[model samples]
Target chain A: MKNIKVLGSGCANCKATFARIEKVARAKGVAVTLEKVEDFAQIAAYGVMSTPGVVIDGKVVHAGGIPEQQQIESWL
Target chain B: MFEQFAHFLVYQLGGLSPASQLGTALHFWVMDTTKILVMLVVVIYFMGLFRTWLSPEKVRRVIQGRSKTLARILAVTLGAMTPFCSCSSVPLFIGFVEAGIPLGITFSFLIASPMINEVAVVLLIGLIGWQLTVLYITAGLTVAYVGGIAMERFHPEKWVEAYVWQIQMGEIAQPAIDTSLRGRHVFAVSQVTEIVGRIWLWVLIGISAGALFHGYVPQTWVAGLSERENWLAVPMAVMLGIPLYSNAVGVIPLAEAMLAKGVALGTTLALMMSIAAISLPELLILRKVMRVPGLLLFVAVLMVAITLVGWLFNLLN
Candidate 1:
């Protein structure tokens, strides 16, 4: 199982990224656990200043803006 | 229209005396708030559209492998145009370093990124006037350009930690931006609501302070300070502002309040720039990439540059 976390303050980009992750996971039939981290302190703890960060297994794979769907699929 | 609306609200419906404290405060609040919010929406929206066309990644691609002189120019201009924040500092720094951009050019971008941007200029125009706005932009760019060149000439790379050069990051592809008019509308509206929501309290606080100054503080007092023209004011303001962290927008109200209270224009501008560009948190974050000496040197260079600009403006005014 893959632990995937989407980090943001619930901005439009964050919501879009969250939706994209779910859609990509469902399409790929991957059993991934997902979570949204909304707290700024927690986001800072991850050493990410920008929002809409995608962390896979504790590694910040992407930070700032929405990642491409193809790139999300690759990360999945 | 803005003045009329404020007049109508207070004088017509509320029937408050313009001579009264409440009346004056409400009038100031209504007029300033409307002007700022209106500008915020129009400017932020168009800026969003502009941002969609010129992403930071694209900026990185263009600056990469360019000559030092050209890189310095692009870095200053693009850094001002690009929408970036302190949170992106580490990654942005790393990205530039990895792209083979020289330390000097990278320093220019880093210095300019937080200092000069559309939001600050728009707010300055709304609150102050066009003359100061132009001065702010030109001074800010000059600081970044000169500071970058100075740092580059000095060669402070030795103070960088060994690990900063070793960290590697692969570029993640960006999603396509919605460039349609409708898309820009949505983006702009969202930006307005988000920014307005976050800063409304500060805006109110600022207006309240301004109102207080307007009603209670004697004009003679401010003029008195100007007449005395304390030499330490500019340097003190720069020092006080550096440790405080804030964005260009968040600091507008306070800047307006200070100016309303008769602070020197150069001193007020210096305070805002320091708050926007330098902060303890930002310095701590940069700690990962630079040693204490390099960090101190960076601070010293910026402080000197900012102080000079402030003094020059004060002299001219």
Candidate 2:
């Protein structure tokens, strides 16, 4: 199981990123607890200044934008 | 090569007279769209890489407990680099307060983060000349810095919500990252793609307005408004801009349009900055943390500063 967190301020891109993660997790049959960290403090804690950041198990694997499914799956 | 291609593509296809409004509009549209889009990609890529090197923790440490003078400047610079949106405003505001960053310093950061936009920079450079671009940047930074300093001097800390001062968070530790050449390059590429992709439509809309203004507006009409009597245009533009909401990218073309239709550069920029700095939505969001008086003060300070910049620029020109 992986704890995957998506960071954004509910902007369009942020919402899309959240949707994409849910879809990808379901397709892979990955046992994951997905969380959306909308709080800027928590998001800034990961040192990801831009939106739609991805964090897996407390480690930020992506920031500033969305990543490919393959890359996201790899992180998971 | 690019210029010739744009000319051939726009002018050759229509087979219309270059002097005609339609032909001129098409030509302006193509030329501006291409230049702005190319600049947006390249500048965003580089800015993303530059952003990766900066962290909120680093910014916190720089200004934490510093004197008002130093913190004001640092806050403006950091705010310019960080792409902060309204959604993140609450948390960032709380975090800054918790970190013992001064109220005024935080205000500077908040003001600059929205006011100094990279998209605005690229579009300004592409549509207008670099001279005005530099002027806008300098004026923006100065306004942010001075407004913050004034806020600090006035000591409006009492107006902040009580809960803000009460929330306690432990020291934020510095984040460790694997700084490799490849990592930065990838980050930069992703940033360019995401930012450019999202804003391409707004850019198109902006250039379209500019195209119409360029093709149809008369020079004498514009010149008439440029005279000193039209100084009222600055305040009028600011007044009109505050109620509307749009990002810097969406407003650039409108600024160009206004400029084309007989508005002064300073007045046009004042309108754009007001849209960013004193936006109603942004103010409403900040109201969550600040009482009405503080919010009013913030808006007043910005209004005065931006107006001053507009008038100064008008005078200098």
Which candidate achieves the best TM-score against the true structure? 2
Residue B24, model 1, lDDT: 85
Task: Give the per-residue lDDT digits (tens) of candidate 2, residues B1-317.
Answer: 55776679877866767777887788778888888888888888888788668766567778888877788888999898777777657656776787788888898998898888788899888887899899888988988998888788778898988876766645443433336977788777878888888888888887887777778778888787655458788888788888878877777878777777666778888998999888887787677778999988888888888899899988887
List candidate 2 stretches off by more than 4 Å. Answer: A1-9, A35-71, B10-23, B171-178, B224-228
Q: In model 2 chain A, which range of ten residues has the least summed lDDT?
A: A41-50
Clashes of each: 1, 0
Q: Which stretches of candidate 1 lie over 4 Å from their true place?
A: A1-31, A34-51, A55-63, A66-76, B18-21, B167-172, B179-184
Cα DockQ of the candidate 2 complex: 0.27
The DockQ-based CAPRI class assigned to model 2 is: acceptable
lDDT tens per residue, model 1, B212-305? 7766777787776666556688899899998788988778778877777678888988898888877787787777678898888888888888
Q: For candidate 1, what is the total of clashing residue pairs?
A: 1
Q: Give the TM-score of candidate 2.
A: 0.86
> How close to the true structure is residue B141 of candidate 1, measured as C-alpha lDDT?
94
* Per-residue alpha-carbon lDDT of candidate 2 for residues A8-69, written as tens digits (9 for 90 to 100): 76777788888888998899888899889876556656655446678788777776555667
User: Interface RMSD computed for candidate 2 is what?
Assistant: 4.9
Model 2: residue B256 alpha-carbon error in angstroms: 1.1
